[model samples]
Target: MNKFVDYFKIGPVFTYFIRVFRKPDPNAPTSQNLRMMHGINRISIVMFLFCLIVMIVRACTR
Candidate 1:
């Protein structure tokens, strides 16, 4: 007799998104190049998610 099934699991993509949005460590060394790279990555990730949502909505409407 199971009370609840373990159907929900946080995948790697979700974890990556969380990591990307999380605040940077105060003690960690900072580099301009690294910051710019992460900024670009964040922008790309946002664009990809927007496109994915749009595709899904279009599919569902049809």
Candidate 2:
């Protein structure tokens, strides 16, 4: 049971997930391409999470 519980623990991936939504560095150099890329990434991340929640809800309802 303990091992099963440990298997679901949040790890380094959680840090990366948080990093994605955090404020960007003020001093970093900016570019049109880089900004567009990050914007797309943020949108995809939100969409992916929305789909994940939908799937989980459907699974639980069944």
Task: Give me the candidate number with maximum TM-score.
Answer: 1
After superposition, candidate 2 runs with Cα above 4 Å error: 1-14
Backbone clash count for every predicted candidate, in the order shown: 0, 0
Tens digit of lDDT per residue, candidate 1, span 1-62?
24344345448668878888778888999899978887888999999999999999999999
lDDT by residue for model 2 (4-42), tens: 989988887778677767787889897999788878888
lDDT of each: 0.84, 0.86
Q: In candidate 2, which residue pairs clash?
A: none
lDDT of 2: 0.86
TM-score (C-alpha) between model 2 and the true structure: 0.69
lDDT of 2 at 8: 89
In candidate 2, position 32 carries an lDDT of 92
